[model samples]
Target: MRILMAGVSGFLGTRLVDLLVADGHQVTRLVRRPPRGPHERQWTPSAAQLDPALVAEADAVVNLAGAGVGDRRWTDQYKQLIRSSRVDATSTLAITIAGLSEADRPEVLLNASAIGWYGNTGDRVVEEDAPPGEGFLADVARVWEAATRPAEDAGVRVVRLRTGLPLHRDGGLLKPQLLPFKLGIAGRLGSGRQWIPWISMSDWLRAVMFLLARADLSGPVNLVGPAPVTNAEFTRELARQLRRPAIIPIPGLALKAVLGGFAQEALTSTRVLPGVLNRAAFSFRLPDLPTALHAALHD
Candidate 1:
């Protein structure tokens, strides 16, 4: 399959490209800068510019484009950047795909969404059918998923990946926790009861491929492990895996002070279930928390 992908330079995107290449799929990267190679295509999402010819050439298009929500302190300006980066890029791609002739349009489009769509679920388990929840990230995700309406309207099998916290030692949610936990100073956040929907990096990529291969599946799919753990449970397991005792707890107020607007999201509880993936019989390589942590740290 010929796959055109945005966000290829990101941590997940880099691995996804490698996996796609290994599986014998031709992956073309959409770059903001000038095309540096034949495999690269220039796009300006801010200007909503994407060549229809580029969309027509691909068998599928996977968009993982977005500003890193947790990458910086969430100032008002950075928050706006987070929203525009995703909504704009997705709208650009969706509109471009919609303009392609029937015969030339790609078969499918996989756009990145997030579990934050459910907002602070507390203890409630959400499936793909769940309605949009409240909060800033939820609003962002609602608009983010809505941006793909053009492609879906054009008969493209569009799938919005409501991804969870991807666990990997090198980057993502696990990286910052590693040093603190390894030093035996880490503990749960706030009440430590907020449900966390997590997935291993391996399962994340596999699920993308799984969705790509299934023409029968479309719309929003929760990309997370079967087992959802509470923040306390997750902290304990991670600390146990590292052979360290975690006793210190960071107050919710402190987190809010440090992370700013991102703190509320961090403290938000979302127990997401992979209903779509489960019904499709998609297999998870790291289905359990222990297994996922082990693979994330050791494998």
Candidate 2:
């Protein structure tokens, strides 16, 4: 399979490309900066390229482009940047691809989304059919997914992957978890009862490829572990892996004081479920919390 990727430099994008290439797939990256490698193609999000010939030649287009949710301090300007970055970039990609000749468009447009769309569901079990949750992140994700509907309407199979915390040591959730545990400060966040829907790095990408291969799989599919863990439980397991004591859970207000608006995201509940994947008989290599925590920290 030939795959075109946007935002190839991101955490998930970088890993997903590696997995796809190792699976012996031809990969092309649409990048913002100067083209760096043999497979890199340059395109600006503001003035994106829209060559039909380029669009039609690929088997699939995997879009993982966007501003990082956890990276910046959420000043008013920064919030706008976050919203504009994802909404504009994704809209451009989808509309451009949709403009291609019907024969030239890729079979699949696997767009990246987030479980944040469900907002703070408390303990509610979130599935693909669940309505969009409220607040900033949820609003951003709703618009982001809506941007891709045009591509789906144009006879291309569009899959919005509502990905959760991808547990990997190299970047993302693993790094922060490490610092706290190393200093013996690792503890549950907020009330500790908030469900933290997460997935192993391996399983997350594997399922993406699975969706790409299966013609029937389209729309939103929650990319989270089948066995979701609460923050308290997740904290205990993480500390267990590092051989540390995970007591004295952090207060939500304290987190809000420190992280401001972003605290709600890291400390609140999502409780997403991969219902479609389970019903389709997909099996996870890292099915439980302890084993996944071990791989993330040790291996």
The TM-score leader among the candidates is: 1
**Poorly placed runs, candidate 1 (over 4 Å):** none
What TM-score quantifies how close candidate 1 is to the native fold?
A: 0.99
Q: Which ten residues in a row have the lowest lDDT in candidate 2?
A: 46-55
Q: How many residue pairs clash in each candidate?
A: 0, 1
Summed over model 2, clashes come to 1
lDDT of 2 by residue, 1-299 (tens): 98888878898988889999999999988888888889988777766554555567798999989888888767788888888878777887788788988878899999989998999999888799999999899999999999997788899999999999989888887786787787887688877898988899889988998999999988999999999989888888887777888776788898888778888788778888999899878889998888887788767
Q: lDDT by residue for model 1 over 193-286, one digit each (tens)?
A: 9999999999999999999999999999999999999999999999999999999999999999899889999999999999999999998988
Model 2: colliding residue pairs: 56-104
- Lowest summed lDDT across 10 adjacent residues in model 1 is found at 117-126
| Alpha-carbon RMSD, candidate 2 | 1.3
